[model samples]
Target: MIAPPARPDSLVRQDRFTTDESTADVAVVIVTYRNADSISTLVDSLRSEAAVSSIRVVVVDNNSGDGTASTLAAHDDVIVVAGEVNLGYAGAINVARSRIGATRAVLILNPDCVVQPGCVTALRAALREPGVVAAVPRLHDVDGRLSFSLRREPRLPATLVDAMLGARLPRRPVWASETIRDVAVYDRAHSIEWATGAAMMMSAGALDAVGPWDERFFLYSEETDYFRRLRSHGLVLYVPEARVEHTGGGSGSSQALSDLLTVNKIRYVQKYHARSFVTAFHAVTLFGEAVRCWSSKHRATYRAVARRHEWSNLLRAETPRPTECRDMGSVVIPAHNESRVIARTLDALADLAARGVVEVIVACNGCTDDTARIAAGRPGVRVLDLDVASKTAAMNGADEVAELWPRVYLDADVVITPAAVVDLVTALADGTLLAARPASRYDATGAGHLVRRYYRARSSLPLVRSHLWGAGCYALSEEGHARVGRFPDVVADDVVVDAAFATDEKIVVDTDPVVVLVPRTPAALIAVLSRNYSGNRDAPATTSSTGTLRHVAGTVHGPGTLLDAAVYCLFAALGRRASRRTSARWARDDTSRT
Candidate 1:
């Protein structure tokens, strides 16, 4: 019999990330708590991925005062978001997703992971099939030794066995027989219950359908929750033909986080498994706790985790609400400096708020003006003043504080009637649509040839015809919010939300038309178009979600639309060229401002 390859000799460590960045096709999210040393080495390895088109690196520094953000700040390609409060691993990932915008695939990675050449390629290739939600690469330890990378869900029998024997013997195959087989037989790729969030290339479409990570889980069981959400959507979790070295052991030393992990695990078991299973798990865990009491080295860490209150929360029949329940349907409007139009937007939805069907949450992010004060003045409109300017962050902050579902992500600039808000909530109540957005009527009176032509041609398409996004506003059903949790930190959140569902699952609710302000001038059009282009930067260039005929038919409404299409083509070519020259903070069209 052939013996397994021996672990490679250790190498010297020199920490650095190369300046070279690809034309990013993937948004690589690295949520670091600390371990700046490990992250530096991993970044260096990632720089070697020149074969990959583009890698957008979003480093969410979860208040790691150890200067991890500053360490990565020098790298031009890296976008670092300061989590002044550690949003935990799951929350960080959700923030990273928004920052990623609309990339074809998202890579959820650990700060300590290093990938081999073609690893990303294989992961991306696996996601080409529609059924595959995520693809995990095989993991090797720093020593290039194969670690225990796969396992079935924790069962009571396995737990009892591992506690009774595996804890003591340390190498008994009988303790975790199936897990042992998984490691031994891992010669090829296969389906798994969940992939380690350490390094997995997930389909953006799948993420849209599954939503964001459940922020309730601090760290440990986040992947399990993600898997559960994905599985609920009938998506497959695939293992691809590639390998990555994920240095096991995160900032796992934090006793608080570790305790939370233990609690999350118990909750996971109780939530998914049977009552008997939970009882068995607690019994098995007690045995392990008893074993730990005999081991002096583990007493502190073990005692910190095995708390009665934490266990009781899970064993109880009722689930704890994430936030207060003053409201049922939530309308979260993320604003930066929209003091001019904030009141009007709030007034439009005042009827729904008055009826008690909705509560408006104006998350005023990075507002220097009286946006918050003005929003707060409105009766029934709750104002959330945020320090960060990110729309995704504001939405997340709102989600964090408000225990409301069937959330509506309303754009401050769009003007939709209160009746429309009522219709949206009513539509959401039926559970027919994953998401719904109003049909738009563009303000074309003051527009130029190119600008008017673009909107006219766009209006003919499915976005105006049968699809969404032409309108700035959209509503998420409770199921929609459940499937796709928090808003990602992105400029074009509508596109990201719109991509998460099929036509059958979502709709263009034209009951009450939404008035969209078109760019008044060619210059304004260029500025707005440039921003729009930037919004679409990392997103899929094209998606089959909307068919070809739907795309073309949008341009053929009338002879006038044919002329509109001609001008639109001219501007599109010109716009694409000008868009490249746009800076990160591109100019917005002020034509809509009253």
Candidate 2:
């Protein structure tokens, strides 16, 4: 296959088309909503176009319930399509075009658009070029400024940058976002990856070749995918001579639109990109959303994006063949007053603990809340309520009850994915690594400024490169557990476990991850850091950290990364100072417990 020729400095010039002399119909398809004012304005704009004779206008109303269909019905030539239910924009456009059957060209327009004089003439003329399948008019905002109507394919760095910092940065970076770079060609009539669906026209031949617009994409990226499909067969031209002023925020400003925009973006990426790229895309997008979510305006949207299951649904297999939880033995969780989040934690672990496959023990020690009651309520969970309030005692009690090889030490607040648990067990079955831990990702919802920056900075490091030093979930074979025997009376159980396993004996589960909840405020961060420092003082030196030369160089990402490092160091010093006041033997930071 040959590549398309390079676009010239300008589109090929053609004579203006005033009338349709050929026996073909030029159909105008408008998908409208609570857009009465725009529709009335569009009527006036369409009336002034002298060259658009014999054109048909069809309006597909998406249950706006605003009496828009009744108003459009009064027009003698307009076809009104009012339905009881809402078909999203792409679906509505499909309905409108299908109703206006066998058209020579279909011009799709948003209701809030005003066509300049001779605009339709220019677009129609451009469509007549040798191999051009579609044409889009140069679009400006209500104020006539160039909008970001053109695009390259959606990419990880570009989308993340656009989300974190809005497209128009004061000083553009060396790796500028796609939206920023696309501005250079906004004024030139040239080929593009895709133009906004708001004001684009498609030839009948193009529609026939590509079939109907994919309804799977309920709203956004429908046009992008459609244009991509069209480009696979023929060319798309941007006609600068033809101009349209768009009052852009139709579905855009709706509060409910954010979720749709997010899922559809993922859907587009998963459909087009490979699995490896999809995982990288999800990580970048989530971290960017998490950073920007600290702002009240975008908090809800980013929170939705932050849900791990949302990405796993698309990233993981649809029908995940149930994994065998491996022959290696028991799962032990130590809890103290964890009623609020214990249900979710155990719920995440239930499938793997099915019917004695793995002994599930929850050692609830000195809980002043209903944690013991709640954990005991789970079908496969065995809860033991001890008298003392100590994680060390709880672990010892759990070890006595479980008494099996390859024990899983887990925290009550963290949610361990069942599939990941199975994967870790299977990974250790080969006996190459004596002990293993699932890599962790911190859930940063409601985190303070310093804490937020820290996690976001940490996101740039390798996903599973760290050792199993202090992960939320780690498994130990009998040989591994014997190396670090019965729970020692220490501040951090994970620290002792890490000290026992050499770098070669421990494996970091890279495929599936374990999710942990991050502390909420700066004080909470200092508390956790203090305990960590106290725990490590008596423990062995860690063979892992976020301070490799590669990591330090990568930390030169923005002000945020540097700030994260600064804050992390400051808190470490503060924690060490604070640890002097607290008991070194028993310190577990549970600031996030509710």
- By TM-score, the best candidate is 1
368-473 in candidate 1: lDDT tens per residue?
9999998888877888888988878988898887666667788788777764665565556557668887545777886676787787776555334444565778
Off by over 4 Å in 1: 1-24, 167-183, 233-240, 296-306, 310-594
| Per-model TM values vs. the true structure | 0.50, 0.49
Worst 10 residues of 1 by lDDT: 315-324
lDDT of each: 0.68, 0.71
Model 2 lDDT tens row, 493-572: 77688768766687665335567788888888877777777777777665344444355455464676678766655665
Separately for all candidates shown, the number of backbone clashes (residues 3 or more apart, or on different chains) is: 13, 0
Q: List the residue pairs that clash in candidate 2.
A: none
After superposing candidate 2 on the true structure, give the runs of residues whose Cα lies further than 4 Å from its correct spot. Answer: 1-24, 170-175, 180-184, 308-594
Most accurate candidate by lDDT = 2
